[model samples]
Target: MGREAVIVGVGDLPLNGGRIVGGGSILQVQARAAKAALDDARIPMSDVDGLLVAGLWGVPGPGLLPSVTLGEYLGIHPRFADSTNIGGAAFEAHVAHAAMAIEMGYCDVALIVYGSNQKSERSRTLGGRPPILTMQFENVWGIPQPVGGYALAARRHMHEFGTTEEQLAEIAVATRGWAALNPAATMRDPITIDDVMNSTPISDPLKLLDCCLVTDGAGAIVMTTADNARAHGSTITHIRGYGEAHTHWSIGAMPDLARLTAAEMASRRAFEMAGITHDAIDLVECYDSFTITVLMTLEALGFCKPGEGGAFVSGQRTAPGGEFPMNTNGGGLSYCHPGMYGIFLLIEAVRQLRGEAGARQVQNVETALVHGTGGTLSSGATVILANN
Candidate 1:
């Protein structure tokens, strides 16, 4: 929090389609995203001393080899590089890690990148287990997929706190409204409360619409010291504060199904470090892998009381130009989800702070809060960005 890390540049490849329009495999999309980010920041690739990449889906290869491979493709021989593979939370934590590295003068500019091709090619079926044989005996029998896992948590929220399925539907309906404004959104059908309610149930309480999209896309963001922002000739969105925390990896290990302890810790630390209250935050970008996930994050982040996320997103509060204005990019719900939806959260947040979003831009978006949770609600990271 002392030495600030500001975003010098941000960019992402088209979040729709995969290996179709010149973007082949996850590696190709990652390179495209990184180049776009460097270009957006107006910084040369040679200037980047540090690189952070996320392990991607598809392109059958070594698990944690993409980061170094990407650096080679970009011709960037960085001193410090990492390929953190903490599920979707990698991108969010990458920002915090880069900020710390820059604060300590470990590197000048760090590029956080993630890309995936879950749609075009994958061995795992829609509701099938991983190709690995071990998962059959250890996991799949317990839960069909992540949707059911999150659905169990959602049902617990409803049972304990009187949360209605309609409330969960509200978040989906509102995010779709924002997606309607985004031309790049995959499913812009303009759904309604009834539409969400009537959709085929994926799990008991969670309907098909309640889940996020599984498209293929990539996103990247560049971070450096505050001085680097000025040197790059880009509008600065300084990283005033950031926080990260992690819980158990699996759902059974979670202390509470309804509450996300990692998000709670990250949100509290982020607000305290930023020296601002929740109301001071003009916008929020929360990782919404599922409707329940968004609701849990809102509650844990103090945007709304515990068990009130369903009611909190009611009446388009998250839609464009709404009072709260959460996830304006249509989010993973309607926007291009790809695999790592976390990176898009930062992209939308930075765009709003820079006033780059055309119709979706909020008025005087000076401060924004972004939270990304990885694993099965296993990890949480938060960042407070301000134009100052």
Candidate 2:
């Protein structure tokens, strides 16, 4: 048998919308989250010999931040650590890397963590310009912020295969249904197809509600070898398969907006690793920074054929108690979007596998597929998780 890495524990801070947290800085939040995860696994902090931290985008200085800062704060230093920033895919990649480290005998226990202050930061303003290093030429020509970029992709899908505005609205409506069950969700009011249709328009085809929530949050995941998982009495959710790929960072350079190449490649590799097909997956946590994101990912992952996402999501297909359960934690659309949207996908996936989600839980979620996209649909990372 090949070397294996398992997620032993997971924890997340409450997603608060009204007020932002200022006392706890990024490092403090991350430390707290990491500690919580370790506690959940019933392991002491001193047992961690490896640490992986998600990179921060808004930091103005040297850019990259390693696990050292949080390590020093938490008083648990590890010899092996990685601080990676591939856009929003950082956390998912960290989890995968932790698995590889344990498999290679480089470490016994690892902590994967992320934290952000998107709400308190002024740079998050809609009119605020991204840093020079973060800016893309595509946005210079009034391409309409992130909303416009995704809207353009959605419009192309409509023109090519009769995809309709109503179809896109279906994603928003269904996600809101999930949000109603999550008290942490920012938008809890039930919405209808008409509500999404008549809502204020941000871009040509995208409405205001079509976008994800803006909030501040932190999350952490604990990884260890299979043997360590069992020895430590941790709730084990094995990483059966995972894949990552990227095309271009800019939307203008994309050959086809409707089809996501990186997502397809990553999903294919992940499915092969897990030795399972789409039918075996009881839950799916597809990143949804925007409504179109979920639609594009659904098609890319073979959940539906190209151009069939809009129709596939209709009739509450992805809603609670639906045929194909998805985004049960309300997702980025209604749950929270703290710039690191991909990290939330990882959080929700682990929560489902642990059967910790009470009201929004799905039945028999023994296996799950999580896909993350970063930048302007530039990078993709897919992880297949199984419990049993």
Candidate 3:
């Protein structure tokens, strides 16, 4: 029999309000999320044979061996451990890694976890200079933080593809509409294109509303062999296929300003591996670090032509009752975006596949595409999940 992996459980920690004062540390948040996942799966902590943790770059602690430290803290010595830090896409990559590990007889069960107190501890300065070698050259140019980098991409996309700021606002408005259905979302108030345009401008082509919220949050997911998932009597979301790709690290080093080639490569590979076409996907859960990110991702993922993202998202195509239901959990733009938003993407995908999305649920979702973008559109990971 061929080996296969299935997600047996998923859990999300409570999101702290934006810039809130008091909240648990990263370790505490991760532990709680892990416990929740274990409980949800009806599995004991000792049953987890693999552990994968997302590393926070600037945060203090066991910098070199974050996964080992987290394992020790959680009191579960796993046979397999990984700490692959590719920015926000780390979690999605971890899912791929965990599935491969399980298929290779390295582990029977795996737990992928992430947690961050960026809003409470760091005041949401996640994209600050990291004292890296690239910063020496890039910082001198006075790049306008992360927002500025995204604005540059937005500008280039607009110039080449005729993408407008109003089109970008459509993404935020549609995502916010989903937020209104989610009580846990940070920004539930519905927004319009005019409201997004009138909001405070953080960058030339990007407004405050276009940016994702800064909040402290954590999430975890449990993946096990398909047979084990059946034994647990849990809602099984099968890992049909996955693929990852990366381009440049720094925004200045990006080869193309208007396009995210990594997303294109990743999504194409995932769809091919899953043996499905773009039209077969019932829903999408993509990282929305900014409105531009979502738009560019849609184009790169083959939802539309290279320069047709603006028109593809027009007329509230991604909103509730729209043809393409996306970001049904409000996305990072309206929900909580800690340092890493990839884990939340998996959580929401699982919810939608399990038919647990409540008011925002898409009817009869059999397949979902979860994509994550990290860095300044530098890295991308795509996972195709199905409920069988």
Candidate 4:
């Protein structure tokens, strides 16, 4: 928190049929989002001296350096460049990195960009094992990818805390309720707990409705020094605090199956840095890869005690008019989930803080908390933003 970093611009491409309309590659959508961000900031590409790009899910060829590729594509000679690949939490981590870079005088203006064509490329089943993950034991035992890993966690939570399937269904139902208010949501129809329970079961205790949507989309954000943002005449959201933590990569290696330890550590650091309690937050933009993810995150973030997430979200507390408005833009469950969902969380949080979230807007939003979980709940990052 040396020199304050503020987000001056945010942009999101229109999600269409799990694809970017007009037949564009992952780079094309990324460029489009980047251009939109630049336009929103009223800053020329020449002014951007830093670049960070998330690794695309369905790139045509194997590339080791995504940030370099993007910088070359965008024709920007950035003084600072980074390609941090922590799955869904990458974007949030990028924000932190960009802030530090600006504070340390590594760069003045930084652009963080992400885009994915997972659905269009039929790459929905892309979460296998990363090169860093050498343990193939789970694969040999037929663990059925992320759905099965998350199902195992969900089942354990149910056993340890008496978290019922109905409680889990409540999360999906409430999120869909919010989605109904969002015009860009993929599935806007209101659903019930019965609808969730009756839906197709992907894994044991996790119905199809419990799972997040698979759609193609892109999002971007521009970060710079607070003085720079003010000089540009931009309505900026200050990055008050941020933190990150990682426990393990593989599900088999996870020390605790019933909880997300990283969320606890990261959120604590963020809250302490921001000097605010859970009650001080007006809204939460949590990465909802699945219904259980949101539930576990709420518990880990101290909104409720461990094992109390079921009761916390039971009566639509996270829905439109709930006491705690969470995932107000439908979240990954109903909103677009194009592989990595961290960027969208930032986008929604920024919109809410700016009072630009029409319909789904949370009233009198002074501060918002955004968190992301990546790689089978292996990694986590928390960011606190305030309009003041």
Candidate 5:
């Protein structure tokens, strides 16, 4: 009964002006999203026997007991519960954890969810961290929080490779192109590389358009045995392969400024487990905390040789009608990025595999690559999904 783990349902809320349309606390919206995912699978909430959740909603008590609090709020006691937080990559890692739990006969149906009210609550800030161990080294420099870290990577990549600012802009412009087709995306207006170049510079070569959207968003995914999903006649995406790794919490500790070693290692392991080649991949959905994030990830994931991402992403290759389709849901760059963006990446991959993405749907999609990066290029998780 537990031969394979497949995702049968996913739910992501709408966004207006890059923020959730309705205001609600993190748990409230997360609960609704959970209900929506369960309903989509034609499974009642009572059927959920496992839960995997991650969030920044609770600080002290609930934060420490994230899964416990979510369980209490949902009014369900699960036989299997996990609250593994690896930053934005946490949700992708959760998928792997749930797959093992389901296959091990610990839980039949598992739910993974994420919700954030940062935008609505105006709680988005890099200023709250207490200056301690790692902070002791970084906090004093006054380097711009996450953006500065990513900018360092971008600058190093440029120095190592012949990558150009125009090449980096191509990612932003292409992502926006897909966002234009996505009604749920916050920034839908068409943008050009020139527009990106002209936008206010945030950190060195990174511009205002290079950063991700700050929005309040919630999403959920439901996974279960393949037999269970087939019995319910639910279209499903196979959780064929997954792997996660992290190298550094702070930028100073990153192994190489020119490359994301964690992404390379994680994707290599996932690809080995799936036995899939680069040509077999139909779509790529990776984290886009910044335009550089996407560019660097593509290179790290072996889609192209290292130091070749800028060239790989140029010419709108990742946009619609291009040879490579990526961030079809606009990604965190244009889509709603509620702190942790990995959950939405999973949902979009499922939707695309199910052929549910109306306009942005790719033809003959059988395999999709979903990757997430958390912290300041601190962690990476890769999941390979198949609709076979």
Candidate 6:
């Protein structure tokens, strides 16, 4: 139970918009991603004893028993199985859960995976979810959810902190710049603040460019005890620290729209466990469902003061060659955002830590912080990773 948790392998299907030109099932993609990760770790499929998954690949009770469904597909009979779904941040929380499970002797090796074909099939109006639970209260109002909620946060930030539309645009533009270097990013063209401002408006002060892409995507991660990783001779990214928390399911219930309270709690716990300050972080990989998400996360994660996020990201500071590197896989804004985007954030962080990201790799990265926000900024999961 005192074992250290470490990531040994990560994998992704070649981004083809999640679905092929015509047909391919989410199950196939998920299986393939799992295989890729296992192969990368040099671990046979038969070796995995734990499974964690999240997705929207079924109906009728919908995603109920996702681990059971995916376990059957991969022929993995995991002793430790978890299918906790906290929206986009689910995978990040899975890492936390898997690490705890492995350390507690509940499981030796764990695979955390996710896949979504939202772009190929589901409607963006609902972001591939039915109005269940608190959503019933939200969807009935005719408010374009998700984006509308983020827009509310953005507008509130501007009102209380004097953040500007141009500042929000800085995030989109910088992330797009990083996308230009990513071979698999869906949106590679470089964009400007004016472009973000002029792009079709979705909600007040939130333009099309400020929003994330709707695309099919799949990714997987393989984690195990440090002994197992060293036994397999796998290059490792150690799970130095991890934390997760959620505030409210509905945007209406959020105490403060301008502040991402969940992110603060999660990242604070993560940093505390890692015994490191913000300066020790080499880079960041965060959920960028909207441009506002990056700004709010930066504040919540303590990269900058709550109101200083606007200035901190100015001049494309997070873009390639900037003092800080973030969302190097282009983030959900430019990278593929298949339904839940948190899995991709973890994958990218692992890749950067391993120096395997090729063109988008951050140089000499010893440690990276990965943060994910889910729901209407309702959930947060932070993982501090290290390869040093």
Per-candidate TM-scores read 0.94, 0.94, 0.97, 0.97, 0.98, 0.96
Model 5 misplacement above 4 A: none
Report the C-alpha lDDT of model 2 over 1-388, residue by residue, as the tens digit: 6557898888777756622344366667777778788899888899999988765533564334557666777788797798876667767777778888889989888988887766755336543456365465654677666677788888888888888888888888889899898887877889998998898988888898888877777888888877878888888897989988888766776669888888998899988888888899899998888888889999999999998888899898988778988888888888888777787788788888888887898878899999998766777899989888
Residue-wise C-alpha lDDT for candidate 4, range 40-65, written one tens digit per residue: 88787889999988765534553468
Q: How accurate is candidate 6 locally (lDDT)?
A: 0.89
For each candidate in the order shown, give its overall lDDT on alpha carbons: 0.81, 0.81, 0.88, 0.88, 0.91, 0.89
Task: Give per-residue lDDT, candidate 6, residue 92.
Answer: 89
Tell me the tens digit of each residue's lDDT in model 1 across 286-348: 888888999999999998899777778877788766788888988888887676678889989
- Checking candidate 2 for backbone clashes, the offending pairs are none
RMSD of each: 2.3, 2.1, 1.6, 1.6, 1.1, 1.7
Among all windows of 10 consecutive residues in model 1, the one with the lowest summed lDDT is 14-23
Stretches off by above 4 angstroms in model 2 are 18-23, 123-136
Task: Pick the winner on lDDT between candidates 4 and 6.
Answer: 6
Error of 2 at 81 (Å): 2.2
lDDT of 5: 0.91
Error of 6 at 5 (Å): 1.1
In terms of lDDT, model 1 sits at 0.81
How many steric clashes between backbone atoms does each model show? 0, 0, 0, 0, 0, 0
Candidate 5 local lDDT, residue 109: 93
lDDT (tens digit, per residue) of candidate 3 on 216-250: 78889999988887888877888888999999887
Which of the predicted structures, 2 or 6, would earn the higher TM-score when compared with the native?
6
Candidate 6 lDDT, tens digit per residue, 1-388? 4698889989987775434334368788788889989999988889899999987667555457889888888987999998988789999899999999999989999999888767777634454446788677877777787798999899999999999999999999999989889988888988888999999989998999999988888789999989999999988898888899999988999979999999999999999999999999998999999999999999999999989999999998999999999999889999788879998898889888888898888899999999999989999999999997
Candidate 5 RMSD to the correct structure: 1.1
